[model samples]
Target: MSIEDRKQKIIAEFSMFDDWMDKYNLLIEMGKSLPVIDPHHKTKSNLISGCQSRVWLQARYENNRVYFTANSDAVITKGIVSLLIRVFNGLPPKEIIEADTAFLDKIGLKEHLSPTRSNGLTSMIKQMKLYALAFKTKHDSDKKED
Candidate 1:
């Protein structure tokens, strides 16, 4: 599915829950569903700095889209990472760049996260976007070389 469709689906799913706790629990559960990364990839270089929990993120470009794998030592943090992965994964560089995370505010994710947690989340997101930017730059440079 397209990222837009997935966004809508996520919004819809969150709407199904009446309480923030329920939604938060569902987000954590979503994190549980993320595929595991290799232990070797969990090094300090992969760690998302500023996160209260140890979070790791890795990205790769394939078939004109970006794919990511992530993990966190804390379950709730993992869930937050999963939400970010879902929102950004499989999107082309341009699309990923264009995406506005305003939905996060609408979903009350930003409001509910503690200040430190919010900072961590922001760091994680910036890292992911950097990956996208790097991919886009390399792709463009390669095309120029060709």
Candidate 2:
């Protein structure tokens, strides 16, 4: 589905919950559904700094799109990361850069997050976008060289 559609779905899901606790529980469940990343790959290179929990993110380019996998020691944090991955993963670099993350506010995510957690989320998003930019640059350079 398109990112816009996914955003709507997420907002709808969030709307179904009566309180923040329920929403948080749902997010935690979402985190549990994230794919397991192997222990060896959880190195400093993949580490997502600024989070209270240890979060690791990895990205790759395939068929001109970027794909990502992430993990976190905190279940809620992992769920937040999972949401981000769903929105940003497997998209072209330019698309990732241009994405309107304003939908996060509509879903009451940023407002509900703790200051530290918000910072961590921002850091993770920035890092993920940076990875996409790097891949785009490398891919373009290789094409030019060819």
Candidate 3:
């Protein structure tokens, strides 16, 4: 599905819960479903620097698309990253880099997060886009060489 469609689905899911506590529970449940990051990719190099908890993100480039896998020491952070990956994964690097994240606000996630978690979320999104940029640059260079 397209990123907008995936984001809309998440917004609809979050809308089902009237309380912030319920939304937090939903995030934790979503965390449980996040795929575990490979042990080899969980290195210091992959760690997101601004997060209070350790967040390791790794990107793989294949067939002109960038795919991400991430893990966080904090459950809420894990869920947040999972949501981002759901929207951005398996897409072309340019699409991943350009995807709008306003759905996060529409879902009431950003406003409800603690200040530290909000910073961490921003770091996560930045890192994802950085990875996409790197992939796009490499792919563009290779195409020129070909």
Top candidate by TM-score: 3
The clash numbers for all candidates, in the given order, read 0, 0, 0
Candidate 1 residue pairs in clash (backbone atoms < 3 Å): none
Q: Could you tell me the lDDT of residue 118 within candidate 2?
A: 38
Highest lDDT among the candidates is held by which one?
A: 3
Which lDDT value does model 1 have at 63? 86
At residue 37, give the lDDT of candidate 2: 67
What does candidate 1's lDDT look like per residue over 1-49, in tens digits? 8887888888888889889899888988999988666787888899988
Cα lDDT tens digits, model 2, 13-127, are 8889878899899899889877666778889989987887889998889999998888998888899888888888778998887787777777768753445643588888888
Cα TM-score of candidate 2: 0.91
The candidate 3 region of ten consecutive residues with least summed lDDT is: 110-119
- Model 1's number of clashes is 0
Badly placed stretches (over 4 Å) of model 2 are 112-118
Cα RMSD to the true fold for all candidates: 1.7, 1.8, 1.8
lDDT (CA) for every model shown? 0.83, 0.83, 0.87
Sorting all predicted structures by lDDT, with the top scorer first, yields: 3, 1, 2
Error of 3 at 63 (Å): 1.2
